[model samples]
Target: MSDINRVAVIGCGTIGMSWASLFLAHGLEVQAYDPAPGREAPLRDFIAVATTSIGRPVPADTTALRWCMELEDAVGNVEFVQENGPDAEDAKRTLLAAIDRLTPAHSVIATSTSSQIRSAITADCRHPERHIVAHPFNPPHLVPLVEILGGADWAVERSTALYRRLGRHPIVMRREMRGHIANRLTSALWREALFILQEGGASVADIDDAVRYGPGLRWAIMGPYLTYHLAGGPGGIRHFLDHLLPGHVKRWAELGTPVLDADLEAKIVQGVLEALGDRSIADCMRARDAMLVALASLSSAADDAQDDLRGDA
Candidate 1:
């Protein structure tokens, strides 16, 4: 992080805008750029309105930020750069090469890339060791997990410190891999859910209910393994593993691979539509986002209290 006070956000799409909002809310000077001509105004406004985390209303003061016309101008003096450009490997390599030429050698470069492996993207950069992957969950300002991978150990430490400064939790990946931990876990769940839906065994809403009213509630506080440990009573993990391992394997085997036939696609669309009847997608997304914002605030406060107690102890 190198005590990052200035950050450059190279793309201003949905994820990019959210990253900019997080930076601004934490009082960082952001220089955002997108080559598209009509983007500056709305992107700036989106960031301005997205600063509700600090309880400061929009249009209060965005004097610190200046949207730039060129990528070079946007990143000229920034201490850190959060790249949210296209996910294509060639495009990322090209942009990173351009950034490597312009940005100071010491500045950390983070990508919001969801799937691309960091090692592959940073291979062409001048300062490959300084380039790290910092993938935040959707609406980066609200969700605290920033999945950091690749780079040197020092780079990960610095990136973690910077995210901490911005009121986020940085989870370091032990290895460089595409789709890191969270996304991999999410994909596993999604794959099974899709399979079930495609087979007409479960509706979209039913799957959501299984999560929202069940595991999701428990997962909010502890992960699956810990939850399972708790479920094992006095015997703990050893007992559960001994008895549950076979059943787990058997159940997983029962879930055969899914093929997306025409009927399945139509069923998926129908189920999704039925679950979201009459509600505009944008409106539904907004509602979900607002809820996440409040949840994140509460979680942060809880974590701070825990930290304080540990310090006292």
Candidate 2:
């Protein structure tokens, strides 16, 4: 939205490569950097596979990104930088210092950090005002939501606009909370999933199927609150809450925390491997992510249609 076409991706690991692919798919020039030598070829291969798998257009005149050995070189001439390094505080502090010094004043500095808050990472930066945490789901190129946090209203507004321009849904957090919104919600679900597994109430595949077939279907179009409101029939969410919430809370209270037992961990690993079978984990994740991307695109289209209908009304 700000003519910010060029993007720099620092740390070209799994998340970094995925972010790069998203930018490149949208015809944005990407400059990438990683300390590992010969990583460029593998990164390029990942982009190719992701683009094909997601059915996203990889332009014929596609300018393959410049891979730099130095971090500053990657940030050069770019309007945005998406950092995807290790989650260690010291590592982030060092990287942010360098990015703060090198990046253009107006460039929007974002991180792929899932756990850290914006303030923690950007505290050392000279222009902390220009920094925001833009965390995307795994396979960022595919998932539509980019959770944006930090800065004042203007910073959040600009970051939201930029992500929207890139065809992403940027959910701006009202506060700089740890783990942000999506991941926090995911953590809640995962916590329950662990309880279910530990209680021997559900298998891994059963839990997966429950989501892929049940509430996940409605979640594609609306938030859980809205879904519950609809479930209330003519009475709305308050009525449903009065009747249903007590039972829900009771069930949640009864669930136990997962024990960090080696046997359980081994069983979990075996279960996942059995689910995946011969398919590589990377390949399986990519395929699953591609479906989610298409689902998100469809949902967005539906939202647009509903808005248009409302306007006509």
Largest TM-score belongs to which candidate? 1
lDDT of each: 0.84, 0.81
Clashing pairs in 1: 1-158
Candidate 1 on 1-313: residue-level lDDT in tens? 4477889999898899888888887778889998877887787778766786445444555586788988999988987899999988888988888888899888888888888877777778878988888989887877788999858777778789989988788988888667888998998888898888877787988988899999998898788999889877799888889887778989988876678789878888888899888999988877877888778777778889999999999
Q: Model 1, residue 236: displacement in angstroms?
A: 2.0
Candidate 2, run of 10 with poorest lDDT: 53-62
Off by over 4 Å in 1: 53-61, 304-313
TM-score of 2: 0.92
Q: Could you tell me which 10 consecutive residues in candidate 1 have the lowest summed lDDT?
A: 53-62
In model 2, which residue pairs have backbone atoms overlapping below 3 Å?
none
What stretches of model 2 exceed 4 Å from their correct place?
Answer: 54-56, 59-61, 277-283
